[model samples]
Target: MRHFLYICLFISITINSQESIDATLIDSSNLNADQIIDIDNFETLYFIKDHTIYKNHSNKKSINYSNYQLGEITTANVFNPLKINLFYKDFNTVVILDNRLAEIFKIDFNTIQPYKNITQVSTGFDNTLWIFNIDFQQLELYDYKTNTTRFSAVPVQSDVLDLESDYNYCWLLTKNYLYQYNYFGSMISKIENTGFTEISKSNGHLILKKDNILYFKHKKKEEIQPVNLPKLLINQFLLTNETLYIYDLEKLHKYQLKIK
Candidate 1:
């Protein structure tokens, strides 16, 4: 009777663990791009090809923006599709594009007063930008309209690996830790590093990737839980709402993330 009880307990534990998270394959389509940037709530696809940023509309024509002089685009922030931010690290410049992929404003950091060696940038609140000034080792909320620094946090100790932000909060991923800051430049939370290479935020939750495995961390939870997903080559991924889009170089797989 003791052996039978142990066997039943083990099966129950296994079943519970496997049902923690469910990934239902919703769609899989062939993708032809060098890198998948993001998919908006409207299901519009944004990608890069030959160093140009392309926006694919569902029922309309596709538009793109490219600056051959900038060498290559380091990253793009499409948080506000109306105002897309493109960072060109090599040139230390950022180009703002309209929804139609038309160049609207260009910021050349080299010519700005009190030069800032900005290594990373993301969209901030109205007429503002979140920038990492390498010289001061600080994350600064820059007011582009006024050409002034609205808020600058204390210097960070480690190199910033990635920087992402919503309108009210900014998440900075460094070599040693991940830090979250509010608009007032207050450090909200500091999470220890655990080989996390990439991060994406959706509705206050963070989806982190370490190696090829993905983990989900809630804003109110301390424990970082691994998301059980079927084995696949994950080259890049984007989290929008409850959908997880993974690009495996040749194809894009869309999965609906459900918690049991």
Candidate 2:
């Protein structure tokens, strides 16, 4: 009788776990490590391999660009499909690329006035950039056109773990909390960190990872919803335009989200 009860309990837990998953596999491929950095809804893929940037379009053609002078690219932003931003943290510079991966403009922060120790950057509205000045522990709205600081927010109390932005809003994640700021550099909202290890945002929706579990939250929802992934081990992942891409053991898995 005891053995039968233990088996039943295990079965019940397995069924409940299977029911929580709300996703379908779309496609997958084997990708090299740290190669893919960003992917847009239009199927445009941005990757960094061998100290060079590669932009691949849906039509299967690709353009490669590199700058040995910048040393190495710390991060790349493909939020605006038309304008791509690359941050060279070592040199404190940003290179803006057009849709075809052509260099439109490059700004070196060391030469600018006020002397910003920029650690991260993202695309902002109307030819502006969302930048975090490590020296001030503040977020700044910088205009690439005139090479000026348009707006600067107050210093954050904690060290920023990651930063993201869209056209209208910017999201900053620290060790203890997450902060939201508008284009005008005003604090809009904040949420407790709650042990989130990774975060990705697109089209007003956010996907957070804590341990092996995933959470989904949108601007419209007050509470985050938990998600059960089919796979347990995730090396890296990204969420954008209703699609979830998970990379594990050199293989990329794409899943279409079916939110409840």
Candidate 3:
């Protein structure tokens, strides 16, 4: 009887653990989106299709911009809906575009005095930019207007895997650690890397992915929760307070989060 009861308990525990990750697919759409960007207080979805950048509003209207001369876009920032920054690593250039996807200004890092190789770039407060100079292995705040380095941190110890920033803070992820810095290039905080490959941040929440599985860590929560992914072959994903969007192949899946 004791052995039988132990077996029953083990089975119950396993079943409960599996059921804890319950999720429902709300809807899906067919779109060849390589990357997606959602704006605040809007129904528009901006994404990359082929070598061109597209802005889709309510799935009713679409806008696009492409430049073959710029080569492939390394990354894009829609931090400020009014101004967009697109980076091309191979050319060492950054192009600033208006809301309509029209080019406003372009910066070629190769021409900058005291030459530096910029591996990552992000928007900063007051018309500034947060950039990681690969040659110096340092984080720099650059004022585009004056073409000056406002501030810079000492060389980081590890190779930065990813860089993210908002108006006030910049987050740097290395192989072994994640460091946060202020606009003045002061180290605000650092956390040990938990072996996650991709990261997304929005409104103070952090989401990470590894092996196609996502982990969500809320700002106040002490633990990270594993997102119940629909499948294990996700191409890319985005998370908001209420929804999780996953892209696999040419389909986009939306899952409504039931977080407490």
The clash tally of candidate 2 reads 0
TM-score of each: 0.91, 0.88, 0.85
Tell me the alpha-carbon RMSD of every candidate.
3.7, 5.6, 4.7
The CA lDDT at 145 in model 2 is 89
Ten-residue segment with the worst summed lDDT in candidate 1? 14-23
How far residue 32's Cα lies from its native spot in candidate 1, in Å, is 1.6
Clashes of each: 0, 0, 0
Which model is ahead, 2 or 3, in terms of lDDT? 2
Comparing candidate 1 with candidate 2, which one achieves the higher lDDT?
A: 1
Tens-digit lDDT string for candidate 2 (152-229): 988888878888899999988887888889888889888999888678887888888888888888677657777656
Model 2 CA deviation exceeding 4 Å by range: 1-21
Ranking by TM-score: 1, 2, 3
Q: Give the residue spans of candidate 3 off by over 4 A.
A: 1-24
Query: How big is the positional error of residue 205 in model 2, measured in Å on the Cα after superposition?
Result: 0.4
Candidate 1's C-alpha lDDT? Answer: 0.89
**Cα lDDT of model 3 by residue, 1-260, tens digit:** 99999999999987754543335689888877677765344646778767788988875668888888978888888878777888889999988888899988888889988787999988888778889998888989988878999998978898788877777678888877777787778897778877877777776666777677887766555456677765546777776556777778788787776666
**lDDT of residue 209 for candidate 2:** 83
